[model samples]
Target: MSQPPENFAASIKDFESWPENLVHQTTCLGVLKAHKTRLDVTEPKLFTQEAEDINVSFLELIESGPTFDNLEVSDDEELQQRLGEASRRGEDPKCRFIFIGAGSPQAPLKISRKMLVRVLSYYQVIPGYVDRLLEFDGRGYARKDMYSGFLSQTLLNHTPTMEVDYLGRSGRQLQLCYNLRSIGRTKRNHLAPCHKQWSFRHGAFHHQFDILKGTAVWITTTADLDLKKRIEKSTGKTGMREDRQFQTPEQCLKSSLTVHLLLCDWAYENLRVYFLWLDGTVEDEMYLLVHNRRIHEEYPQIYSLGDLEALRNLQEQTKGALQVLKGNIGVFSGLRDFYHGLGENDGFSLRDSCIGDISSFTRQIDNIIDETKRYLAQGQLIAKIIDARETIIFQHFQSQATEKTEQLTTNMQRHSLTVRIIVFLISIYLPATFASTIFSIDVFKYQDQDPISTSNASDPIKQLVSIPAIALDRWLQVTLPMTCLTFAAAGLWLWREDRKLRREYQTTPICTN
Candidate 1:
């Protein structure tokens, strides 16, 4: 085996400096061998051994090389002769399979980066592909729509470039990245709804296949036990007896594609279940809302803010589920196209049953997309209903507030009228009372200086009365200054109170809601 170029080796060294969190640690490796009509799948080995042990095993496999090199013989007779000799000698063709799994749903593995780089290099994968594989951050990548369509530039750009021979006889690689959604189990018991308690885990399925070399690798940021079991049980075993020849690289490729199809099926089933759960949850909430509306008609205080918020949250989740379904549609379509393209390019017709199965799978996925869209529409409609109910609730409260304010204003007006009548009565009686008390005092006196007799009664203006003007001037001088002082104090108090109100209004924050 040839050594990696100096620059490539240097690049691999850079990975040694990567943080521990960036490395993938848990990896499983498997080897498959084909002997004439029989296929054998070795038990997969996890990477728990020492580094030296791993390096020895890895180097041995690399030196042994692929088993289907004899397929390069163009002449049919020569190819048959070689295959016969190998079969007689019990030298079976073999392929290497690797699975890179995460430590948990939220964390990627910490596998040695150098070993990963070596494996990719042995398969003749370019540096760009290695860079992408190592640099992928699940947290960041999960936020974006990675797959739009098979022919989309986004897919093309992310897919690694592969090298092919002049005659296109070798070096064909296919890479597919897809999303998988699964429900996680929890031991905690709570009063929350089951949907709220249920945890959903999202993972990306990464697959790289070297069609001619029989080397394949699967990577995921989240561990999937179902996928692992399926791959192990179905590896190297084609269900079709007529297609059991497994000696040619094309047959191996078909088997590999079958495994991918199984993965797609698994993904589709999970999505269907998840969608149904969401639909049912939304439907339940809608029913509750309708029932609540009836109750609200009788007792308006029975409104629940939490129910409306929960409904909105469910709608958002449904929207996200719809996006996932759409992305899966693109994946299914792309795989269908890939199968056909491979058959056309290789000049060998793939199994009719296999093609039919893939076509049917694609159609089923289309049905899923349609159903998801309808569910999303229903979610939106429910959301609008919630909004309308909220509007009605708000108006009801507002009218109650208006009625209370009107009653309060009428009470205040009645109280003001009673106060004004009391003040008017006081004003009318106060001056009369003050004048009677003052005249009764000895400050003013009337005297008759001459008495009129019966004979003098005919004479007018005989009697005279004496009164003092100084008493009236003294009372006016004292009352005028006292009234002016009282008015000044009242005015000052009112001005200060108005200023305090202005200051408070300026300091307080106005609520936008």
Candidate 2:
């Protein structure tokens, strides 16, 4: 057997007064005890009990030793000889199985340093084993090296000396630590439990077993209470079942192995269900995107900015979930490989049937992962299509805008030509009209009475459009003051309008491009 450190007692003493913050507080404890019966009976009967104090119970077990009595003589001569030899050699022939489960499933169990030291001391486990157990926390994904079990140096040496002749038999001691993801149902409405909402939780536990002494201790945290109940119930049923046999401690250990297998099966089934849900969701999203694309093609204006934004959000959310699912697949693969290693390891004798079940789970999960990859690719394609279609719609609107601008420019140019022609005509007739009005003011006579005497009388055009003559002084006096006054008034109005425009421009807020 492996020995504890030389200062084991001192170490335990040091932990006795250790602060509470540094250790785990005590919680609920459950015990399963299996006592060996007659040699002829193939399996030992199991009993369940509860412990009020962890330290006291452990102390009792250590002091009292194996609970089964091996002194009674058997009827079979060969078996009796073996028993007698074992007794003479100071060995306990009768096997006793004791399983102590500590802590509830809702939270992780905290073992005080003192309690840890005590348990390790009683089991004669090496000090290095403490470091392994210390790493156990019931959260996070399991790494490749997370879920593992191994045979210690002492167990490897003791296995060859065992009297049993079974193939691939387990050693006297074994240590396994594992983490599993468990699924549970959540009631969106308490009145409607069948509404099909589900959540995921994790369970992590450490198992330490001494086969010869029939003692097993399990330390767990953040485990699923319901799953633990199921395990406990199943273990009880196996002990009570008539067909099953537990003739040796190895057989009992095998039953425990079955529990682990059952757990794996349960976890795998839940994960499969979860993946199917994800597949359906992603498929539905893809269909919706395809439908939207068709609508955009037929009636592009129907889709608004808000609609596109919502679709983009949905796509991102789905992508994130898929990424999480991929990670889960990786973690599940690690779990599968951990169990596969157990099946091959000589220390645990996990049957071929169990390994086969693991393989089946692997193949199914792999298929789901492949399908998930295809969905990811399809999602990316849809995103690109949306971007391309949006660009096309924007370009179409831009072209329409350009066509309207060109039309406006042509109309403005035509209007400007009309205005220029009107200005030219006015410029030519304005001087002549002003001069006619001044001379027609009775300041000069047309000489119509002596038309024949006038020189222009002979020319019909000149006689019809005659230029009247007026006194030079009167004409200058009449036009000069009016012209100067008109010019001065126009200048004053222009100056006032310019100042008004400047003020308005200063008050207006200028928008920058």
Q: Give the top-scoring candidate (lDDT).
A: 1
lDDT of candidates 1 onward, in order: 0.44, 0.42
Q: Which lDDT tens digits does candidate 1 get at residues 213-259?
A: 44444544344345654555554243344223344555555555665
Q: How close is candidate 2 to the true structure, as a TM-score?
A: 0.41
447 in model 1: Cα distance from truth in Å? Answer: 20
For every model in order, what is the number of clashing pairs? 7, 4
User: Which predicted model would earn the best TM-score?
Assistant: 1
Q: Model 2, 408: alpha-carbon shift in Å? A: 18
In model 2, how large is the Cα lDDT of residue 499? 86
lDDT at 433 for candidate 2?
A: 53
